[model samples]
Target: MIAATADAAEPDSARQRELVRLVRQDCGSCHGMTLKGGLGLPLTAEALRDKPFDGLVATVVYGRPGTAMPPWKTMISENEAEWIVRQLMQGFPEEAR
Candidate 1:
């Protein structure tokens, strides 16, 4: 089980790049192409600088059920989702926008 879990995880570098790409492409539609916030709150450094990883993951996986945000489980894998959360906590990469 442990090995299976490990195997299922994305490599750090790949996950980081994938997260950057996804946020730049998909998330931009709502979060803004710059992630400076749009219909949703800014995903900027000041906004997410102190947010916890788990909270971010929950938001990504389940979304704000009643809001415009939609759960992303169908579009993104669990590992990838977590990677995105990591990216959010770390702030967007320059190339992401």
Candidate 2:
């Protein structure tokens, strides 16, 4: 489980760009291209409004066993996961294309 007080280490410009791409493409594959829910639940700001930060991080890190959500801890760092949780909570970034 990730710490509730985990520091948010922002990624660099290039990394940030890649992260956004991953969110829009890889994650979008299951969460829906528009993040409105498909095989996975919606990730819109309204959908994740009540979700706890730590819980979101854990879900990303450990994933939901028995569900389609696979663990992303290997793909992203604790800080990156935290960053993503915050982004989802605040409304995930839009896809430029």
Candidate 3:
């Protein structure tokens, strides 16, 4: 299990860029190019406002079973997953050009 805390450090700038691309390209395929919703649920800040933060992080790391959301544990660390959830809840960043 992830040894997560509210004080988890954010990913470095370079890795942050990579995570953005992963979300936009891989995750966007289902969450929508704009994360507004598609085969997957909308990841917009508004849609996630009332949702639990840690739960979202867990979904990213472990994924929702019996669904198309596959676990990303092999690709990302728990801290990285936490960072992504924070960014998504605040309006995910666009990939750097």
Candidate 4:
């Protein structure tokens, strides 16, 4: 399980790179090639920055049943999803905006 790092201590450049990779590889598949959000909600910092970590983890693992989002419990470990959520909250590449 990949754990979410505390970005408050991470270098901006490193966070930017990681966020790009995650958006392109992990989130892009469902959130659209640009992560402008499709079946899933937009991954903007304004949408997630103030959200609780646990809530984000739960959504990724269990998904919103009535929504197009699918549960990812079998595909990704909880911690990995948490890490992705953390990255989403930080912001992604300019293309993702």
For residues 1-97, could you state the per-residue lDDT of candidate 2 as single tens digits?
Answer: 4433355658767777788889889999999878898899999999998888899988988899999999987788878887888888888888566
Q: What TM-score goes with each of the models?
A: 0.76, 0.87, 0.90, 0.62
By TM-score, how accurate is candidate 1?
0.76
Weakest 10 consecutive residues of candidate 1 by summed lDDT = 1-10
Per residue, candidate 3 scores C-alpha lDDT tens digits across 1-97 of 4554467678889989999999999999999979999999999999999999999988999999999999998889899998899999999998878
| Whole-model lDDT per candidate | 0.74, 0.84, 0.91, 0.67
- Sorting all predicted structures by lDDT, with the top scorer first, yields 3, 2, 1, 4
Among all candidates shown, the one with the greatest TM-score:
3
- Compare the candidates by lDDT and give the number of the best one: 3
In candidate 1, list every pair of residues with a backbone clash: none
Q: Which residue runs of candidate 2 sit more than 4 Å off their true CA positions? A: 1-8
Candidate 3: pairs in clash? none
Tell me the tens digit of each residue's lDDT in model 1 across 1-95: 01123555664776577767778768888889789888888888688887887888778877898899888877676677776767667776756
Q: Which runs of model 4 end up more than 4 angstroms from their true locations?
A: 1-26, 93-97
| TM-score of predicted structure 3 | 0.90
Candidate 1 global lDDT: 0.74
